[model samples]
Target: MSLHCPSPATMPPADLPAPAPHTPIEDLQALITGCLFVALSILMLRESRLLTGGTTGLSFLIHYLSGWRLGLVMFLVNLPFYAFGLAALGKRFTFKTFCAVGTLSLFTELIPGLVHFDRLDPVFAAVMGGLLAGIGILILMRHGASLGGSGVLAIYLQKTRGWRAGSVQMSVDVLILSLGLLVISPGEVGLSILSAAALNLVIGINHRPDRYFGF
Candidate 1:
């Protein structure tokens, strides 16, 4: 995401904003697929004894420390962020994000009962998990939705203050992943960094504001 969005009124006649809203069916499908991908990424990270960043990473940290269900914790951890999302991103985005977060929680809880991995490679898990999470987030962002927390803030900054969403996201990830060290080993933290890099790389290269027009 880039920082220099020209408002329709201020833009030249040839550069006016032209955002085509998503259809209900398209949004529903995207919400489902995006949440499912993030859920699967969480599963991979959990099984491989790793964590990434953002609210998901925070949820993992709490889950590791509290022996709580990751899905439930994730849902709860995202609660307060809804207020900021509603204020900054608008009602439609907030509503979609609420549903997306809830769906992700449900999927994370249910997927384990349906799938299992006896031996997951850590390196593969880190890369694939990051990629999956990145793709999921990209889908949501394109549809005027986010996973809440820093995702919302990232988008808001891009839309209003002209900050790069990818850069803002990575900065937050660095902080959250640093805290992961308290709960995980140094090596696991390194993998977590790799995952964040892969995840943000997708966002940095593909989700630029110059390319993204949906609102």
Candidate 2:
């Protein structure tokens, strides 16, 4: 009680604590799943020419216009969104998303060379692609990794403006699909919309917090 300490103003500022590092196991699992989902999505989408939402959807749109690899376009397009993610979602999320997006891109490029289906049916492709993409998305969500396309914007909007990620993502997807009306017929656009709807349904239901815990 007698001793007097230095004034609070004179004291040095406390060093900020570092963030908890993600385990290698966690990172590895996320990467694997992300890549798998992206690859499968490409396979499915290529068969049906259907578009999903997010950066991937944009990638598909560009691919449709240019006959380029959707996977490559997906990776390239999402590169810019990483910065937004880092600023809004923090380092851990940014890193995970980066890893997921990069892995997915690489897989997209590599899968085509390695795998091919002989008799491709558009309907089967659409449904399976939606399922694979949905499953892949679920994996990334569980591990805190994102594809980092529209998702980056969605996250930012949710944090800063209190918007819903699902709604933001859906809107972007719809816009992307609308562009298909020019190149693809109304029937194809309808199918594309259906594929996207299926993808969203899977992500929404499986990714619920209370239902599927334990990352």
Candidate 3:
């Protein structure tokens, strides 16, 4: 008896296989992650008198300058990105992201009044805020959902050209943070940068590829 491997001629066509479908549990996890992302974002923003990076950060910047509701600004800023995400990512990802964004917007508007963090010390605020936001972002990532800022572009570039998501995110984050120079004082800019670093730090340490695949 001889052991033989199938030749290329006998191999199954790649196109004939269907993509694996996500289960209900996966969807529930995504929704829970989205809720956490929103809650943490609002908590961070309110606690630190600071902003998150990416489009949510931009929304805060706009709110600071214009007195508009932060949630409204977030929703508006993210609108254009939805189409971009749909094209670059996929329907499931895009839909989850959209839901995440909406939930975040609603929470941003509702959480401030419901939960107060007015007395948190600035240093503690920054550190805790970053930690919470980092964990929340990690959840979104695990579920194939994004908050729709630099994240969208990061995934797009990663897929198209085999770029690392972290590098792309860092580049976009740097650019977005630079905008703070024009809107916020230099000292606040420094704090924002620190908070941003903390967010990435958690992501870097806790979300290693080997450990991130499961819930």
Candidate 4:
């Protein structure tokens, strides 16, 4: 059965079931599922030569400018953020974030060879990629993990300080996409904004504290 958390203002009845920690199996599947969605979204964005938000977008910029492997760049770029996650979010969260980052990097490397799209429309790719990314991120967050970088900070602020994760992420996303003008075309940047909007909208609307009551 699905577990919907009670509102913060509402007290559970005496016999209400206590929230249980996610099983290792559940976390593993969630990591795989979440990363796969993000991996596919990355492929779509790469095909369209579009930018995304977060360190992923920064990695894309470096990849474009240096002609380096995106997976490697992505993994490296997210490295320092793990330390911050560990300090701010604790061990399990940081460990899962680390694993999530590695798995996403690996998926980004492998998915391209396995899946091919002959003619992916740019607009659809932008929106669909954003939607997939949002869903993926939501899965990771609910499972007590994140993609590192701004994601870690966003979650930290949300949990400790009551800031909206989506808002924090959205602000950073705008700056990163704005910086995209240095590498990508204005038109692509505009589309990237649409993608960011689709992404942040999902988080803004759904990632509330009372939505889930588990770590």
List the RMSD of every prediction in angstroms: 4.1, 11.4, 9.4, 4.6
**Candidate 4 residue spans exceeding 4 A from truth:** 1-15, 154-168, 211-215
Instruction: Tell me the tens digit of each residue's lDDT in model 1 across 71-118.
Output: 999999989878767766679778988998899999999999988998
The better-scoring model by lDDT among 3 and 4 is 4
At residue 75, what lDDT does model 3 achieve?
84
Q: Which lDDT value does model 4 have at 56?
A: 94
84, model 3: CA deviation in Å?
Answer: 2.2
Candidate 4 Cα deviation (angstroms), residue 168: 5.1
After superposition, the stretches of candidate 3 with alpha carbons farther than 4 Å from their true spots are 1-26, 158-165
Q: CA shift at 73, candidate 2, in angstroms?
A: 1.5
| Model 3: per-residue Cα lDDT over 4-65, one tens digit each | 11112332345655335557788677667656655765576555666667787778779888
Candidate 1 CA-lDDT value: 0.80
Q: Give all candidates' CA lDDT scores.
A: 0.80, 0.70, 0.68, 0.81
Q: For candidate 4, write residues 1-215 as lDDT tens digits.
A: 00111234333344767667789999999999999998999999999999988889989889989999999999999997776677667898789888989999999999999999999999999999988898888888778777887777776677789998668876877788888999999999998888877776776567666444443
Task: Order candidates by TM-score, high to low.
Answer: 4, 1, 2, 3
Q: After superposition, how far is residue 105 of candidate 3 from its true place, in Å?
A: 0.6
What CA RMSD would candidate 2 show?
Answer: 11.4
lDDT of 2 by residue, 76-121 (tens): 8988888877878789878877777778878878887877788877
Q: Give the worst 10-residue stretch by lDDT in candidate 4.
A: 1-10
Alpha carbon lDDT at 94, candidate 1: 86
- The TM-score, computed over Cα atoms with residue i paired to residue i, of candidate 1 is 0.84
